[model samples]
Target: MIETANYTAYFDKARLAGRKLNLAPAVINAILEDVALAAIANTDRILAENQKDLDRMNPSDPKYDRLKLTAERIQAIANDIMDVARLDSPLGKVLMEDTRPNGLNLKKVRVPLGVVGVIYEARPNVTFDVFALCFKTGNVAILKGGSDADYSNRAIISVIHEVLLKHNIDVNAATLLPAEREATEALLNAREYVDVLIPRGSQGLINFVRNNSKVPVIETGAGIVHIFFDEFADLDKGIGIIFNSKTRRVSVCNALDCLLIHKSRLGDLEKITSRLLDKDVELFVDEESFKVIENHYPVHLLHKAEPEHFGTEFLAMKMAIKTVTNLEEALDHIAQYSSKHSEAIISENANNIERFLNEVDAAAVYANASTAFTDGAQFGLGAEIGISTQKLHARGPMGLEELTSYKWIVNGNGQTRDH
Candidate 1:
């Protein structure tokens, strides 16, 4: 764990190193391939490091699964990096060109956001994803992961640095800091070196960064996601999507947190929740939805929904259910509770679907689909740092292009403004 003073030195070195490299896609791709190979080849060692962190966590703890990096998850990271490698470079591209009447030629070209900083929770995959995306986009990365994944983050960063060393590239391009509040505080206000700060994890983490950081912040990944079961929904399709969204990977941010059902479509509630019930998903239902299935099995699993339950993001085998009178009510509920991350509506009615798509304020709005598709890889953007929830700079799954800023280059021969 490096202290703040040392981290500042590292950040300075990284910024200079990144500017010197002016990385091209070929070199970045080669480095990414080596990183992927190293991760796959050293799976045993990596898992061993991850185990040290996992052993300290309670099995019932929702974050326990998040902190544990298995073979499949590691492979997914490798595959994503490979995909990013194959994509075209995002930097130095000419976005727009303009010729002024006064003989000034102006062009807007994409450039790296310079040194990017990310402060995240126990998800170790972020270590590799951040490294890959930042390297590809030619932006240096400074990472500060949660203390729970200290061993895992260290191991991952070591592998990345090994790749850099092999390529004779500077390792500071992607450096990790100590998992402490001091480091975080230093990073938040390290506007001198860090070009931008992106916080990925719980709502609390995002809020903390937004309030404390002096550097520009990009808020991501606090999905109080919702799925609406409209009256026109195809029950078979709706059931599977809801079940998958809620149960596929409950520990992730994009997993469904709330379920809104139209009053007329309450007949098949049990059918949709059957899989969730099998997984022992607890249901906190509003008055209308509760009376419909109060007599069902697993009496302990059923509970009356409280005010807090509606707005909470349950990163576990739990969800809140509320009955809505119509599309307007459903839209209103989602507007009030959504973290502006991901929202979906299961309806075949064209008008209802269109309204939902056009009005929902989330970063992603899906019709007749699961909100789980709100991912960088899933959207064909390769590995994402996180789903940006804020409106400025970027929104939705942030990819290589989102990691860049544009600068206007003007060519003029003594052109002066006329008074």
Candidate 2:
């Protein structure tokens, strides 16, 4: 049981230790390497434990399948850790150095955010990702993963703690909360202990964490991604991008949730819509789009999209479809409905592409590319803690640098401000 007093004491000690360690880049890199190797070594055990969890869970549960880890998934987690270690460390670097004419020397240096509380659901791989990113930035992390994958998460955390202990590092640096909802609630309210709270999962979970947590939060907006196919779009590329975005990996945060085709391209909508149907994607088409493809395909008529659908992050094989009059209309629709997570414009017109890229307020805006590329690994940041849709702190796939904050260090020769 994590007593409130115990948590407070642990946090104070952690902060003190963090100050003392002043972890250098080389030390951070070495620790990451060790953890990666440990993760690789324990892949078999992680998979077995995950399978056990899956067997006990109801197959109908949405998270049951997502929580299950295979050998390949375990290997992928190890790879992500190694990738994070290869990236540049974001600690102790001098961001700026300057001296005033009054002989005051000021230096801004990058520093860790002390302690990060990561609350996530389903995916057990997040355990490794959060540890790698946080430890690399010299921040201690307290993970509170969903209960569905409790056993698997426990196994992975045990290996990480063992690795930390082997290197004489504090094992509490990578702590896991008790597998209980009440424990999570307690942690959320423990604002004095946790420095920042990052919730990664469904919209509901993120909302709950944001609303309930007393600690500062970096909202990783749930993805309700969209793809707009302009009249000038290359049919081949647009169709391919849309299909891949919707079907490549439907069970991710960045999968395409909606597809918008220009009304001028209504003739081609049937062909593209047919292909999506082949992949079992449920289409919710607007009046114009329905009129164009209704004869050829069976689709659910969407008279009006609910406000919820506009911001909904459906991590499944479902998508909404609409037809716009012009590029302006499309852009307006996107601005109104988008989650500001990821939006794509498939147009061969350079002006349209440039406009979309510049005007869209999102973490990632794509031109001719699929919305699926809005990933940390794909963005070449190694691994991500989470994708921040908010403008403050971190705005996209948060890697090592986003895990840190800045502090100004002053060197003075008995300089005092005269009131």
Candidate 3:
């Protein structure tokens, strides 16, 4: 088992190398291209290892569903690496440059965040995404993935390590924690080793990391996304967005969990609800929505939405249904209930769309589009480490640029402060 101190020493060395190399965007892209090719070439080995992991996993285990990797999944991971290779390098670029009246020049330049600690769960694809993003941005990353996907994650990490070694780069730039739960706990408390901790998975996991981690934490919320269909919303567009948002890959964090409709639109709610029911979606409807749909369909009726329901991240075919009096009410409901992850307004009215986009306090806000578009690939970010709901460091889909921080560079001729 690798100790936390050993991991910290590796990262410290990587950071020193990063500061010295000052890698250009083109060079970074080339390295990424090599990594992508390595992954693709080793696809067969990767999939075989992943299948072995799946076979050993218990089917009844809650995480079993998230641990399986298919051919399409592997291809998607390879494609994501290629896409990341094409993105602009996030290091050494000048963000701002100016000269003071006294001829002292100042520049704000992009720099790596040094060493980042990523704790994630149950998706082998994340192994690739994290490696590419951190490597491209010149940050050393320590990945502590879930035990369920340990085999797959290790296989992918091995391929990446090979690529780094082939390029004469230190393999320690990306380190994987030993497959042990206690190691993760120890790593979380190692603030001296880790600069920041980014956890991606269940709300429980994020909460655990936040509470126990001594390192700076960037909280990524469990998404409780919402879709508000205003009175003036085009029925066709509304149905399309809602269906796509809820049904197109329901297992993701950005999937819609609640649907809010204007009360005036209740007359047409039956049609929408019918379509959703046909797709096997369970509706947890509010009192008013229940009355309109109860006569035609069976639903889980509740008099009032509990605070827990409002903040619940139902990452499945279940959704909470509510009817608002007006756009204002809908906005208020969203502000109060949303997880600040993603929100959408399906309406033809420009004023309403503008208001929703401007006022919604979320990582991604959409108008006349499905909340599902709040993804890294959809937003042209190549690959994302995770979707950040936190406001301080990074928000929205976290790409290469989000993985970096900025520093000020000054050029002056031997001048003393305040003579």
List the lowest-lDDT window of 10 residues for candidate 1: 1-10
Per-residue CA lDDT of model 2 for 236-343, tens digit only, reads 898899999988877777899888888889899978877787777776667777777767765353234444555566677678887788889889988987888999
Best prediction by lDDT: 1
* Cα error of candidate 1 at position 194, Å: 0.8
Q: Quick one: ranking by lDDT, best first?
A: 1, 3, 2
Who wins the TM-score comparison?
1
Question: Which pairs clash in the backbone of model 1?
Answer: none
In candidate 3, stretches whose alpha carbon ends up further than 4 angstroms from where it belongs are 1-21, 56-65, 298-307
Candidate 3 TM-score versus the reference? 0.92
Task: Compose the digit string of candidate 1's lDDT tens values, residues 372-413.
Answer: 888899998889999998889999999999999999999999
Report the CA-based lDDT of candidate 2 relative to the real structure.
Answer: 0.83
Using TM-score as the yardstick, the better of models 1 and 3 is 1
